[model samples]
Target: MTEQEELVICVPGQRLCVADKSNVAGAGTYEQQGYIYSKLAGIVKLVTDDKTRTVEVHSITEQSIVPAPGDIVTAMVTVVNQRFCKCSIKCVGDIVLTRPYRGILRKEDVRAIDKDKLEMYKCYRPGDIILARVMPMTEIHSYQLSTAENELGVVIAHSDEEIRQMMHGFGDSSEPLFESAKIIEDVVLQQMKIIVRRACEIADRRANSKKSNIINGEDLLFLLRKDKIRLQRIVKYLELKELGCSVQKLMTANDVPQNVTDPEQLDIKKKVPFQSFLEQIDNTGELLENSSSVDDVKRRRCIRADIASKSMDEVHYMKFSKARRVSFANKNRHKFSDWICADGDVTVSKQAYTILSYLAYETVAQIVDLAFLVRQDQGKMHGDAIDRQRLNYINPFTFKPRYHSKNFVMKPLTPSEITEALRRYWSPQLDMTGPFNRWSMRRPHLKLLSC
Candidate 1:
């Protein structure tokens, strides 16, 4: 093999050459499907012999090393107890390990001077980086660790208060500390994963119960309903997203005037500028033009009309009555009218009165139309002679009874029966001939007996 061929680098699973009797697979190389592939990421080497050529890959990276007895190691305390503390070994001597190894530090080995009095919590807390010596392995899983020497102790320690201070920006200003950020991020990600996994499992179960292979939104909604807080958060997020998207679309499509100089001046309760209002009208026109369907255009128009009607109603109320204006101004307070003198009489202009009357008429008309529809439905049900007793028991609005009892059957009274019952209960002749009336009457009947 030439020097140029020796310089060829190959990654894991990369094909090197065709495998044959003349070319045999060597270390770090495997032969499959008549091809020799590299199992390590390194430079490809070809060794030539008398009969065959050997293909191999020499790795460029260092091999993983583990802590041995008597080796000095640096580790972070993970769990602390009164008897012992558990740590994760990060480095051996000067070299950092690719992955951490488990180590146990007993309280007796915390310090040589006060071995008996040493407490694991005082010597090493969780998140503290410490130096220790690896002892002979007592267990196959974790290595025994000792910090008996003066030098072998906590190198860096951060208390809970210090972490809180750092999070709240009260710590050192020169450098930003984010030691706990990664841990927090990992915990949050794990929680999210658990929630999503559970939701997916529920959805899968629901789909299976319904004899379906596809899970729909209803299944997910059922899962979300079980966690109301999370569902509320999701709903709030969706609403904000929708609002942001609408704002973004408006900003992108039109050159809206920036009247307010500061963000603080942009209040929802503040009156809109004339220019902004006109610009909104123009933007709405543009939106209508860009709408994909007639339904979209009609929906937008209806929303606009609703907003206009609400504003107009507010204007009419404020103009027609000073009491309403005061109430509107002091909306946050209960009994706002008590703080100010109410008008003895409201003097409504003809135009305001006309608008209010029309609004009332429209509202009543809508109510009447709804009632007529309900009555028609009831008539059709009655005409069909299907469940007539149940129909009488049902309410018009909800189409369900106010109360239901299995023990008692309800029978609705007819108008004539109700009138007859009232007449019998309050007959004029019965009331006039009562003992109370006889006691209050004049004694003219007694005079006839004397005559």
Candidate 2:
């Protein structure tokens, strides 16, 4: 081919011009069986002189490069062990490679002196960038590397903990500070941008799933909840925000008169009247009754007496105890007499009857809450009642008749059967197993029991 001729593109192993005295194989080409064949998928070129011609194949793009013997390469250590360190060659000589090639550095090839005493971990670590000379290809698709020379070893080394500390502005002061204030600021800004981008992506995905465009605070809260430590702070902040209070005010506010009109200004240490405490309880009950959101239900359930005391006062504590006693007396007034004269032989005290009634109410309330949660998890609306199967699952106390049995009787479980059921369902945790075992032993003769 002449310089004026049309360009001929040839792939590897494709036959080109015949090999003769006037034509010879050049770079990217090989002479085989009296024919010049292309060794690379590129354009075939011909170089002519007065005596002979050299046929070659040149790539359509930049010249193809690979790490060859004695060529220096930059590699990032992927793994390091006692025997060898594995890395991926990122650059050949001064040229950055488009794709990484596998390289291995044995412990013996790490340094020239004391090769036998050299430890791979001491010389290099994972994520370390190192310079090494390519020895030769020993295995398929992998290059043998060596850093025995004085100037070829770990060029950059930073442990994960070091990187984390640097990111948090707590890096070691002993080391030379190469990073400037601007660089630190830029890194922080870039990190914030990434976090914001990730949060937006999550919110957008959730909104898309709901077939909506508006992302709400709940989505951001969901993201925060993924980090358990941050979740607690976020929850506290939200609770304080909802109550129209701040942490500083809550900490510094003094005990004031109960006559304070604004709830936010009310002193947590001030004594709350019995009537006011009762009113708060009634309001809480009303809120629970009218709650439509599952989150509202959860929030209400998390309200503890101690947490409420933080906003109210110690006077409410005594009032709360008295109110509970009064409520229990009113609820079991009629049943107290029946419980005392039960079967004309057994007698039950008012306190015992009240305790039983309180336990029964608590269990029923918990079952109701669990049923609502199960229905919500099933993608049901607030108005939707729990299905029969789910209701049975939530309230295991419900009698499920064994219709398939020969004696299909509708009866309550015996004491032994109840104990067995409790043992089977309850996990072997201290709180659960200790109480259960003690209760079972104390009431081994009881006819019926409900968890």
Candidate 3:
């Protein structure tokens, strides 16, 4: 009721909506009246135009674009295929069992205890109602739907074929049904809670770290911190060793090149406490002359350039690792998507993969025959598996089947590794400076996620 809330008041004279955009061509429609909605609860986020009036609407929390692993959904059974029963989702993103959606209840994931006893017909007849959960969204953008709860069954249905047929196309079907699907909504909701609660428990058990287990900015930060520290140590240690050796070569050289011995360029004249040695040698010239020999200044070859060039491999290694962290985070959150309840044959998720771990999957996998053999020959590559191993082949956010079981995973890495990897990853590309947390992760890698 705040004054700042923009609302469309019904004009006293107009029967239908009329706005600037409406007169241009055709902006509004009677079929989509829910376009105008209250500020508090409304499913419709987009408004066609300024002329549309806003009204108080209701929304049942359920499955949405970014569903967690255990969020339950309500759906109406649509197609009964050989291995699965497709349904139309009435609820999305959250755990709303009142409004269902279209989903495919796969034959295998039909029940909680004994899946073999699940006869598709007994479980659900066409046009029957159902309750399911967001198990996993496939890369192809289909909801890997499941009705694995004791009470997650048909909630509402209309036995009369003609009435149900009319209802399908009707804008609103609040009328009482032959088999009141509304009555079963609460029951489905009850069972959905139990099932979802249990599913969360299972996810928690599978989680390795509280931070790593849940996909967010905090986990990214943790991983980056660890990686950065280790990388810094490696870089600093290498540089220190290289510098130390250069000074050592300068101190004990008989005929090193003048250019190579340039103190300004070579950094070989670092202040050393060698005055005592010089004084001792000068005072005891006879003893020093006897001790110092031609062999002492025989000009040993310098290995500074060789060592520095060899360390460049660290950059390649780190780049792949950086992408892998993004990939890993993407893989970990792969199960969480808005695409879960979408059509498989067509569009999947509305978004793209937010991680880059799977970027060079095929190319890298090709080089490593052992990896290729394991995935191609044995054929056990899956997104979940890649997430467990932190591989990069497919972007995990969108539902594209091609990236699902990307067959490459660079190993010896875990969720903690992504943090340090981001410094090298995000640092090189964009000047984004923030904790490598969930928010930071959600922040696209500018060039990587732009467009």
TM-score for every candidate vs. truth? Answer: 0.26, 0.32, 0.22
> How would you order the candidates by TM-score, starting with the best?
2, 1, 3
User: Alpha-carbon error at 268 in model 2, in Å?
Assistant: 36
How far in Å is the alpha carbon of 154 misplaced in model 1?
0.6
**285-365 per-residue lDDT for model 3 (tens digits):** 432132323321011101211221233355433443333223112443343232122223322221112211221121122
Better candidate by lDDT, 1 or 2: 2
Candidate with more favorable, higher lDDT: 1 or 3: 1
- Candidate 1, run of 10 with poorest lDDT: 442-451
Query: Per-residue lDDT of 283-391 in model 1, one digit per residue for the tens?
Result: 3344213234333322432342233233234443233233211211123122212211223332223222222222222222222222222343544544333422122
Give residue 418's error in model 2 in angstroms.
39
Candidate 2 local Cα displacement, residue 196, angstroms:
7.7
Candidate 1 Cα errors over 4 Å, as ranges: 1-60, 161-451
TM-score of 2: 0.32
| Model 2, span 138-190: residue lDDT tens | 89778899998988988876433222222111111112122322232233233
RMSD of each: 31.3, 25.1, 25.7
Query: After TM-score superposition, what is the CA distance of residue 146 in candidate 3 from its true location, in Å?
Result: 1.7
Index of the highest-lDDT prediction: 2
Error in Å for residue 50 of model 3:
40
Clashes of 2: 0
Candidate 2 Cα outliers beyond 4 Å, as residue runs: 1-41, 44-57, 61-64, 161-451
